[model samples]
Structures are given as C-alpha cells and as structure tokens.
Target: MSWGTLRNSGQERELFKRRSFVAIIAIILLTGVLVGRFYYLQIIEHETYATISDRNRLQVQPVPPTRGLIHDRNGVLLAENRPVFSLTVIPEQVSDMDALIEEIRGIVQVRPEDVESFQRRLGERRRPFEPVPLRYHLSESEMARLAVNRHSLPGVETEARLVRYYPYGRLTAHVLGYVGRINEQDASRIDQVAYAGTHYIGKTGLERVYEEELHGEVGYQNVETNARGRVMRVLEREDPTPGRDLTLSLDIRLQQVAHEALGDRRGAIVAINPETGGLLAQVSTPGFDTNKFVTGIDHENYSELRDSLDKPLFNRATRGQYPPGSTIKPMMALAGLASDTVTQSDVVHDPGYYKLPNSSQVFRNWKRGGHGDTTLYDAIVLSSDTYFYKMAYEMGGAEMADYLEHFGFGSVTSLDVSDERAGILPGPQWKRRVHGEPWYPGDSVNMGIGQGYFLSTPMQLAATTSVIANRGARRPPRHLRYIDGDIPARHLLPDVVRPPVEMGEKSDWEYVINAMEDVVHGSNGTARGISPGLNYRMAGKTGTSQVFSLEGEEYDEDEVAERMRDHALFVAFAPADDPEIVVSVLVENGGSGSATAAPVARQVMDAWINGFPEVLTNQAIPGAMENNGPSGRDPQ
Candidate 1:
C-alpha cells in the first residue's frame, strides 16, 4: 500500500475509537444521574412521602377523665358520679344524619327534645368530623334495645361517661349545686384545649365555685387509621389526670332534719359548728331537683321551676334578706353592755310605747299592756321591742349601726358560695345614699328592734350567732372543707376577725346569754313550749317582724290573710355554758316566734345533739312541706 493510504486508514480508525470513547462516557454519566435522582427520592426525602401517606389515614381523639366525688364531714357520700351511656353521631361520617335519626327513632323512643338538642349542636361552629352528643343518661332498657340494632346504624355510637349525682337530692341542692351541659356562653369562657372532649360544667353553688378542681384534665391519643378514619391502633397516648376530691363541712343528717323541720314554710335555716365556723346544714325551702339540671333539663321543666310562685330555683338561705325583728334585742343588749352605755341591772320603764325624744310617732310594744318594768336581761329574754326601741334611741343611730356592723350584720358571710347579699346597714351616710333621705330618730328606734330599714340574711344571722357562741372569737362561716386528692388546692380563706368590741369590764354579754337560756328554761319564758324535753340548754332570742301595717292599728292574725302575717324568727346557741352549735331559723308568715320558729330550731338542735333520725334510717327526703298543726297556725 502507498504511504498516503496507510496514514488515511490510521486516521479513520483513530476517529472511530474517539467516537466510541465519547459514547461510553455519555452512557456512564446518564446512569450516574439516574441513580442519584432515585437515591434522593427514596432515602433523603423518605419522611416527607411517609407523612403525606399518613395524612390520608390517621385519627386523633381526646379522652376525658372521671370527675371526683364529694363527701360530707361525717363521711356520708353527698355528691357522686354515676356511669351513663350516651348516643352520638359524627356529622362527617353520616351519609344522611336526619334520615338515620328518623330510622333509629322507630327502634327506640326518641323525644323532640333529643332531636332539638342534636340539631342545635349540629349547627354550632365546630369541626365536621368531631362527634356530637345526641342522647344522654340512657335507660337500661333503652340501651339494650339500641345495642341489638347498633350494627345496622351507621355513624351512630354509644359512649360510657360519668354523670354527676346529688344523692341527697333537693336537700343539699342549694349548697352542692348541680352540673349542666356546656353552652355557647360557657364555651366562650372555657379553655378550648383543656376542655376539648368535655361536655358538662358546674353551674352554681360549690360546683361553680370549685369547677377547676372538680373537672379533671383532658388527654389525647394519636392512632393509625384507615382511609375511612377508623382507628386501627394507638400510636401514642397521654393519660388524663382525674379531678380532685372534696370534703364538705355539711352534716347530711343535720341537713335532712333541717329540711324536714322547715316543711312547707317559705324561709331558711342555717346551722353551724360554733368552734370551727363550719356550716352543718343550710336549708332553703322550695329548692328544685338538682338532677333536673344535669344532662340538660327540658324547656317545660325548666320553665315550671322559673315561673313557680314558690321560687324553687331561688336559694333562700344565702340569698333571702329580711328585717331581723326582735332577734336583734340580744345583740343590741350585748352592744350596750360592751359600750358601757347600759348595765346588766339597768331598768327601763315600759309604758307600752316608745317616743323618740322629739318625735310624735309612737313605737308601740307587741304586747298592748306593755311589760311592766324590764331590766336589760328581762328585756332580752322577753324580746320586749319597747325596751330595745328606747335603748336604740339612747345609743344614737351611728353608735348602734357601728356596733351592729361589728357583729357581721349588713355584710356578706364567708360561706364560699358566690352571690351572697350584703344587706342594708342603715346609717346617716347609707340612708342619704340609698334612699336619698336624712336619718330620722324613728329610724333608729326601728333599727334597734331589728325592723325599719335594717335588713339581714340568714347566713349573716348564723355568723353573728357563731360569734356569740365563741364569746367574740369570730370565724366567718364556711360551707366546704378542703381535701387534697387529684384536685388543685382550694382558694385560701382570707384572714378575718370581728372588730374588737371590748367584752371585758362593763360588758353584760354573760347576763344577756344567761337571759337567753332562761327564755327557753325559766318560768314564763317565751320559748318554754319547745323546751320541755331538752338534754342541754340553748340560749336564744325570738322575733316577730311585721310584714304589713295599718299606720295606727294593731295586727290581728285572724283578720289578716295567711300570706300577710308576720314572720317568726329565732336565733340560738346550744349547751349555753359550752356552746357547740349556733342555729338560726326563720318562718315566713307562720306567726309567733315561740310557736313557729322555736320548735323548728328545737328539731334541728336535737338532730345535731343526739342523732339524725332520717339519716340513720336511710329514708328519702320528703318534699318541702310545712306543719299545719295548731302550733303552726296563725297565732291568736
């Protein structure tokens, strides 16, 4: 071959080799790029894809803790938790909720109220997937019937929850209060995260005051779910902490006795341990069933309670304010003795009426013939209004008002219940501000006898009686006893002391106490009717507050309508020498403090001193009723 031909052939072979090398390099680079992309997607971004996959399958749910129980001082269960089966529906899960509910109705008894409640909750602003309650507190028969057909019903579920119970029923209704369904108003104020799965909350009394401690914490769980949001298994969970337990100061036995003693009378009874200031019983007649509020009460039932003349919803013990009448005589006499304005032996002539130094209006005594001449002790024991009227005038309005305020009059007691009324304490400034009128001498006379514009609550009377029993060691009354369990610590009680009214030298506190005892034990004593079978002595003062007047006429119970009669009041501390309990009883339009109020007080004291009969027998509390015996009739 020629030299040129050899060179061309070698160049062609080299060119072909260079093209093969370049192609091989391109193939290797493309393989490397593909491998890198696959590695990034499968290994580096694995969690991102997994999370996206889970988004289509997992469910989260809340678990509510059981509410704690409540007991009285004597270890009797007062408030308890009862298991309840409820039916619910998740709107998002139901293909047609209305149709499903209608279908379920044919199998079970469903009321309009149930339908209305379900619809109302359905309309609320909430997540569509969350379950809404349909029926609560299901009956055993109903649960059994529903169970048989549960498999056929789609999106319908049965859940077991604890329902609050007041075992004492209406007896302790006002004090323990009741729980109700969480409404929009309550939802607005509650912590959404903490109360995520809860439905009920305390509405009033101790229940409302201790809601945080009573309601346990909520817990959450994350679960692996299917495409339909059905739970397969829990991936993680946080356990819920239970609510705290409470020990109350109430004595269930004493509460029952007080409730029974009141009968049908429209008034209140407050009994307390004099030493510790613990409330033994607080009875407010006409209290409604606390169970009605739990699990949501119907409109008709609720309306009946709200519109009833007896005011079943009203709490008369802590809320009723009334003119104290002759119940103030003993306290006033004590004030006179402590202030050195009057001595124990000090005598005042009674001419049946009191004339405020320069006034024409005569304040007459209840007895038309007047109590001849009465000493401070006799005046208190007899509850002679004329004597107090004179003493009040002599002491001046400002002094009397100041001293009475020291006794806890015209002030809210420390019962821990919210909405306590601070009654009127008539003074020159108060009169000017409230009634826009100047103080009058006649006002002082009336105030001294626990009438006129002076007003006080039954709780206030109990507090004052406690002070008297303790001989001036005033501890504000309390309705609850603190017990640490799963509950948050209760709010600390504020330091309180009744003003230091000197009880030493000139104070005739002893004389007044002695006289009060005599009223129940001595001859011709006003309250002797109820004292026949007493084991211990009790010092008390009786009172009659006029509900109506005739400007210049005496009251005749026979002619007056039953509703317009005078209110009977009595306040006492038992075992006078070493007082253990202080009691205050008031009967509306019952006439005669001795005949009406004293006997009720006697029954209460007996229950506290001996044994509570009804409690021992495990008898159910009778309805609010009154004794119609001759003793309870309008007095002659």
Candidate 2:
C-alpha cells in the first residue's frame, strides 16, 4: 500500500502548482486596483480635494461702511453716528442655548426679551457662523463683566459698532426721522450681500427717502480661520466706500423757534423759502425722543409712545388733514377771479345766513348781524361766510376742485417728504366715488368756506400760499437743497417745477393780494390787533375749523371739551409786495385763530425776518393788542 502511494506524489504536485498560480494572479489584480485608486485621488483630483480642505479653514466676511452724516443748512448736525458696545452670540458655537442664556444673565442684565429676540434671529436664514446681536448699548460695567466671563462663554462676543444718533432730540424727530435695527422683513427687501454686516436701516422721513445714498457699499475680506471657526487673520481685503453726506435745506434755528412757539399745544407749522422752494422749518409738536428708536427702544417705552393720548408719534406736518377753513379764502378768491365765477367788485347782501336754492339747511355767518352789503374785498377782510357761500354756489364743486388741484391741493406737495397724505378736495365724481351719493349744492356751499368735505395738509397750504406770493409761479416744496458726492450728472433728480396758475386778468392777482393785505392791516380787519409793531408788511388770513356740527346752536367755547373745540389756522407771507417766506400754521382745538394761532405765526415770521434776537425780544414783550377779543374765529 505504501509503494502505491509514492507513485501519485507527482500528480498531487502538479495540481498544487496550478492552484498556487491562480491565487498569485488574483492577488496581483487586487493590488493593481488599489494602486490605480490612489493615483486618481492624489493626482487627478488634487485641486478638488485641496479646495474642500481650504474652505474648512478660510472664510469670506463682509464689512459695512460708515453711514452718512446729516446736517442742516447752517451746517448744524442733525444726525450723527456714535460708537457703542453690544453683546453678540453665535448659536452654533453654543452647546446648550438655554443654559448659555442663563449663564449670560449672571454677568449682565440680560432681559427675557433680549433672549427672545436672539432666538428669533437664530431661526431666520442668515450667513453661517455670523454673530447675532443679543443686547445693545452696553455700559462700561457690563462690558467689564463680559470681559471677565469671556473664557467660560464659548460663543459670546463684545463688539464696538457705530449706531445712528439724533442730536436735536424731539425737535427734529418728525422731519429727520430715525433709524432702527434691521429685521427679517428688512432682510428680505435688502441685498443680502450688501447688508451682510449692517444692522441699521432708515425707518422714515428724509432718512428713508435718501436711503440709497446713505447706505454705503460693502467691503469684503478673505480670512483664515482656526478649527473653532474663529478668524485667525485677514488674508486679503477690499476696502468699502463711504456713504455721501447730505445737507438739508432745513434751518435748525427756525425749526427750534417754530417748535417753541407751538409750546405744549398739539399743532404743526410749515415754512417755505418762497424764492427757492426750500422748506426752512417743519414742526410737529409733542414729538418723541428719536434717540430711543435707534438702539432698540424698550418694549415698555415703545408701548407708552405707541398708546399716548396726545399722539407724539404722529407727523402732523405731512400727515394731519384738517379743514382749511378761512385759510383757504384767499385761494378761493383767486379761483373766483380765474374761473370768471365772480368779479373783484361783485357785491352780495348778507343777512347772517345763506341757503341753497331748494335746501332747508341754512349756513350761518360768524357775525350774527352780517356785514350789510359786502364786496369781495370786504368779504375777505371781514371773513364773510355768506358772501363766499354764494360764490361757491355759483362756481359749483367741479370748477372749485379743478382750480384748487393746480394749487397743489388734493395731492402730495413734495416727493422728498415721506408719508405725505394727499388732502381731500371734494367734487361731484369724488363724492360719488367716496360716499356713493351725488354732490349736493349744500356740499358746495360748505366747501366754499373750506369746510364739510374739504381737507388740506399744512404742507399743501404752505405750497398754495407760495403761488399767491409768487403771483402765479409755482414750485413744489423741496427738502434737499443739493446732494454732495461724485454722482453722475444724469443720475441727479431734476428740481421740482410746476406750471403757473393763470388768472383772467393780471390785475386780478393784485386785487386778491390787496384784499389779503387788508386782513391784517385794515382798520376793521379781524387780525388788525397783531399789526401794530410790524417791522414788515404781511398779508394773512385766519380761520376756525369746527370739530363737530353746531346744528343751529351757537358755539360756546367754555361748554365744549378742550379736545372737541374748534381748530385755529392761519396762513401768511411776509413783506407782502416782495415776499420771501410763506408760512402755514395749525393749532388743534386752540379755539380762536387770532388768540392762539396768528400770534404764533407772527412770532415765527419775526424770527425769520429779524433773526433770533427778535424771537427773544418778542417773547419778553407781549403784543400791544392782546386784549382784542377773539375776532379771528371765522364762521365755518
């Protein structure tokens, strides 16, 4: 058996050799595949792999440029930028958000609202690893505490950034407006790349109107970062372009004077330089401190401002709509002459009240016994309600509306003024569209005296008066005198120019002007008491707008609530023959135009003509005729 086994050894060896060769071939194929894979990754795809590695270590960041400065015509700073400290956080770097927030409370006075706001921003889509603002306006003590606790807090950071500041406080709040922190809504509207590091945006007024010029170009930096995602160094950078400065036409001195003249009363005043259409002063009383709005106004303070009874937040100059009252009489007189509805010498017999041909409603005159026989000039000086009532009936609503539209009424006066309301100038079509009713002759009578459906803003009134001062020339009100920068000439906006209102006879303009002049200077003028110590001659009109209908009852000022009393209004242009300024004043619930509003206008005009010396001197001494008994409260 052993000998037989020895003969089969050669056959077994052959089989073993074949099996070993097959195993060697299989191993060679596997090694070749491994070598090919290494070559492809290291050589062919080197650039792609290297880019991925570099991205993890480097980041591109945006830098916001400095915001523009705002100044008045006198070079007085109205708005500026001040550096402030803020606390910020990066959510991804935080291990436990709630725990981190609780820890932050110990170092600083971190409010629940702050944490809530931070959480809200974290949920919004933003650049990855960008720091979110937690709290602004950090005090020195808070900064110290943060610095000491920095090592323990992973994501917390303290940054110094420039924030918007209003120097005039409540004086220019309505005109200059204010800036506020950018929110999700702002983020959606703005260019994300341009606004990457920017936090503030203009909220209203001139700030909003010229936002594009105020917000500068963004800069970028390629930065190397560490494993923790902190910036190690800036590898490359592109500098940002600064925003252009703006010099507004507002005269701060006049603005302050007008504001002080209004005092505690809720009122508005708009003064325009007749020669240039520049708004010298725009004042809305009971204005709030604009500084609080810039760095996130506290919720309690904001709520107080939002719900105040006096409405300090309201921009009365551009938004308040009130019946023009007798302030529109001069314009109405011009409209009469222009449309051939009435002649300068036309006479109307007034017996205290006027009635439409078929209507039972009787519109009463301010005088119980009216000016017996009144001409156009007599009607204006005495503010005869019956005379204008008949004239309004003659001209009709359509004619009156068309004439007034050319005077910048029923529309916004300035494109630069934000949130301006177009006042209502009622006509037949307007009545049908708004009230779903036909225009009545009674409506015409009421509107003729600037009541019922007629409403006008202070800005519109000032613009209209400018046309009268210029003898038919019209220039829309403007805030920007000029923009200072390297802007292309073609890109600049054209100056606002409007077509002049044509009168039937050139002599008609002088006739109306002379009548307005008599309103303040005539012996029997309603505002005659305010004319004694005039350094200049001025033409003016005074008006009273009723808050509620008397319904045939005599208006008793003492019986009415202060808020429900009549509104006093006055419009005037100084140096009547060669006017330089046009002013419109409105006093809400101020009772009589002569007693409350006219004196204020006189003071403002005196300030503009004679400078700040006159303002102080006039305030020290009362007008000689302060005893004149409420003669300027015209019938509405």
Candidate 3:
C-alpha cells in the first residue's frame, strides 16, 4: 500500500486546475457588474443627483417689497418707512441655539421679552428657511459690535430693513394709526407666502383698513450660500411690485391747528369738506406717540398709555360718544321742518320750563328765565331748550328718529373710516328694547335738547352739519381722497352713498339755514360772541350737556367738580352761503357751550378760513357802531 501512494502526483495536479478555473470565472463576473454600476451612477442619473447637490449650496430667498407712503391732502407725509438695523437668526443654520443666543447677548442688549418672542415665532408655522427677528431698531454701536464679532457666530445676522415711522408724533396718531410686529393672531390670518420676509403689519386706523393695498407683492431671488447659510452671491432675481401710495383728505396744517387749540383738553374735533365729503381735519387730544407702538412698546410704556385716565390710546374723534347738547338743535330744527311738525314761523312760549300736557314733571330750560315767545328762528338763534322740547313733543319719537336717520344719525357715516361708532338715537323701539319701558312724553322732551340717552360721535355731528351745509344733500365723510395718483370722480366712495334728505319745500332749507346764520350773527344769538371780525358769514349753534342729572337743581359751575360738570359742544359751517367746511367740536366737562366750546370752534374756523392767522387782528364789528359796543359780544 505505501508503494502505490508514492506515485499520486498526477491526481493532485488535476484537482488544482479545477479550483483555478472557478476562481477565474468569479473574477470576470464581478468586473462586469462593477462597470455597469459605475456607468449607471456616472451617466444615467447625473442630472438628478447634480440637482440635489446644488440645492444644498444654493437657496431661494424672499424679498419684501417696500410699504406704501401716506400723505395728507397737502402732500405732507403722515406715515413713511425708514431704514433700521435688526438682529435675525435662522434656526436651521444654528448648531446650538442657546449658545448662539448667549453669545449675541454679549454684543447686543437682548431683552428677555425679545428672546421669548423670538422663541414663540420659532415655534410658529412659517415659511422654510426664513429668518426670525430677535431684536429690532438696533443702535449703530450695537450693529458695529455685532459686525466685528460676526465671524464667530454661525446663524446670527444683522440686516437692514424698512420700518414704519410717523413724523407727526401724536398729532395724527388716531387717524394714521401704527404698525406692529407680526404676532400669532396676525400670522394666522395673513398670506404666509406673501409675508415670508415681512415682520410687521398694520394694527389700527387707516393702516389697518388698507393693509392689503399697503402691503406690496413679494419677490424672490436665487442665492448661493456657504455652509453656515451666509449668502455668497445672488444669481437670479424677480423684482417686487411696490405698494400704492395714498393721498388722504386730511390737512396736516389744519390738524396741527386743531390739536394746538385743544391743548391739554380731553376732547375731539372733526372738520369735513361739505362739497367733497372729505375729512379736512380730525383730531383727538391727549393722543399718545404712535411710534412707540411700531417697535413693540415696552410693558411699562404700554401700561402707562392703557392705564392713563385720559385714555391716550382711544380714538375720540371716531369712537367717543357724547351728548350732542344744543349741537343737536340745528338738526332737530331741520327735522321739524322736514316732517312739517313745526313751521319756521311757529311760536312757542318758553316760560323757563316745559311740562307734559298730563304730567307735572316739568322739564326746565337751560336759561332760568326762558326765551319768551320764541319762534323757530328765535329758538335756534337763542338755543331755547323749552322751544325744542315742545317741537320734539309735537313730532313724537318715531318721526324724529326717521328724520334724523336720513342725516346718518344712529348709523355709521363713512364706509372707509374704520371702527366708527354708530351712536344711539333713542326712539320708542330703542327705549323699549334697551330700558324695557314704553316711550314716555318726558323722554321726548329730554331728547329734544339732546339728552336722556341721546348720544352722537364727533364724526357724526360733523356729517350732520355737512348735510345742512349741502342743503339736504347727504355725503358720507371719507378720509381716502385718492389712491396711487388715480383721482376717480369727486366723491370716490360710492358705497357710503345715502339718500338725499328731502323737504316739502326747497325754500325750507334756505329758511332753516338763515335761522342758523342768525345763531352766530344775530343781535341775540347764543353764539354771537364768536362773530367778531366780518371776514366771512358763518352759521353755528352752541350746546351744553350735563354729565349728571340736575334734578331741578341749578348748575353752579364753581361748586361742581371739573370732571362732573357739563360738556360744551358746537356745530358750524363757514361762509354760510357757499360753505366749504363743516366742523364739530366737543369739550368734555366744559361748563358753557357758548363760552368754552364756541371760542375753540372760532379758532379752528379761523384756521381753515384764514390760513391760521399768526396774529389775530382787531377789526371793527360789522354793526358795532350802531350797537355802540365792542367788536365781540359776551357768550350767553
């Protein structure tokens, strides 16, 4: 057996050849598979993979369009946009958000509220890759410091953006309103794609009303960026469409004059162009600086405004409701004439007070010894409350309400004005619904003189006067005169159109207007004190509304608290024959309308008529020589 195994070399060689053949075949198959895979990746799918890689290096960014500018009728800037520096952060680019925020605190003063707000926005649903603002309105020094140390920060950036600014400060705060940083409530309602890079939105007044027109179209750009998300260069861009510029009906000069005249008083004044229905000047005193609200007002500053007794944040011109007092008499007189309840020649014997035919509850007149044997003309000129009491009693509440509604009472007057209150013009139905009582004769008497639940806003009062100036033609008040240099017709606001107030006889309008003229120019007119220089003919009525019920007690101005006293009011139109401006003034806690409120009306009227005379001239009265007295008469 040992001799046979020694000669087995040939069998061993054949086994080695079979193993080599298997190894060679495996190598050839693997080489073919590797070549096919390389071709598939390098040639067939090149475009798709190339696109994926380019997306990592390049980004599509949104560019916010510039906001529109706002100007007054005289082309004075009310609201404008100014460049400001702000700190922003992109969360996706940040590796450690807490560490980056801490580092930013060293370069810039970041408030806790700011950081909290930033965190809140970070959690909100926003466009992908958009930067969130951490701090706004940065100082130049802070920006410089951040620029020098920016190399160490990855996601932090200092960007210059346009911010809203009001040049008039508090003068136009109520009318122009303000812009504030976008919040959760605003973000939810806004178009996210359009506002991708925008951070602010209008909060109130005209700004809020015209937000869509003011916010321009958003644009986009393709930009190359580094690993840290820093933009290296812009490749392609689509320019944005700018917002439409606005021209308001307000006059800044007149606004300045009205604000200065009201000085330190809590009141409202509204002046409108009777012909065009455009607001000439709208002012609410004790207004706060609107700029504070634009950049997120601090808690302390906001509390001061919100808690102040004067309510600086309130828009009194459009929202404040006050008793019209005698200011309602002119409209009431027109209402009486329109309904034929009382004629221009009808007489009422005002004997210090009025009483219902069956009830003994006497409604006393403002004048203790009342205007005796007062005609409609004499009653208006002298502001005889007793005469109006009788007229209102004769007309009844329903007829009176229907007549006044035609002048836009108890309803919103302007379609364009935001947040205007529809004041209460109480009638039988309104009284029954609100007080759960039937309309009593005494209620009519009290309402006749603009009291007993009667309320009207300064805007409404001005609109009423405008109707009288137009001789029963109704034109709703409007602030927007034109948009983007396009002046459509004279009265552009067609939506605010109201039916014309018709009188049985057209001459009735002239008769009532003449009586109103006598109220300022007549020898016994209640507002005669304001008719000094005869530069122009004006018609006006004075009014006083008691804050508290007198209950048969005489009003002693010195005894009552200033805040508890009567409110002074006046309504007027200048150049009586061809009226251009109609104005209404309301002074809170002012004792006498003729004394306290009329002078302010005179001053404002003079401002509009004579361009706010630098120095009031001393001219002789029109009939002072015959009267043999001073140019000006004492207020009644």
In model 2, the runs with Cα more than 4 Å from the true position are: 1-44, 485-492, 614-636
Distance from true location, Cα of 577 in model 3, Å: 0.8
Write down the TM-score of every candidate: 0.87, 0.89, 0.90
Scored by CA lDDT, what does every candidate get? 0.81, 0.85, 0.84
Candidate 3 regions exceeding 4 Å error are 1-37, 489-492, 495-499, 613-636
What tens-digit string does per-residue lDDT give for candidate 2 at 1-636? Answer: 688866888899999999999999999998999888988888999899889989999888888988998876655678889999999998889999889888988888988778777787888777777889999889999999899998889888899999998878798999989888787788889998888788888988888888888889989889998877777899999988877788777777678789999999999999998766878899998999999888777788889999998999999899999999998898899899888888987899999989878778789998898898999999999999999999999999999999988988899887589899999999999999999999988899999999999999999999999988988878778787656622321244455567556755778888888888888898987778789898788898999998888776899999999999999999999889988789999999998887788899998898777656444324522221121122110110
How displaced is residue 507 in candidate 2, in Å? Answer: 1.7
Q: Write the per-residue lDDT of candidate 1 for residues 1-636, one digit (tens) a residue.
A: 778765777788999999999999999999999999989988999899878887767667787877877877645677888988988787887898879999889877779998997898887766447778888877888888888997778777777888998888788889988888787888889998888888789999888887888898999888887756667899989988888888777777678778889998788999988777778889999788898888888889999989998788888788888888888887888888777778877898887888776567788888887888999888877777788888888888888888888788888877587767887879888899888999888888888898889888888888887877777778888876666532322355543566447754423567778898998998867898888879889998888888877778778899999889999899999889888789999888888889999999999898776655643435443331232231111110
Stretches off by above 4 angstroms in model 1 are: 1-46, 125-128, 139-154, 485-491, 494-499, 503-507, 614-636
**Candidate 3 root-mean-square deviation in Å:** 6.7
Clashes of each: 5, 0, 0
lDDT score at residue 540, model 3, on the 0-100 scale: 88
Model 3 has how many clashing residue pairs?
A: 0
lDDT of 3 by residue, 318-406 (tens): 99998888888878887888788988789999999998898878888888989889898888888899999999999998888888888
The lowest-lDDT stretch of 10 consecutive residues in candidate 2 is 627-636
RMSD of each: 7.9, 6.9, 6.7
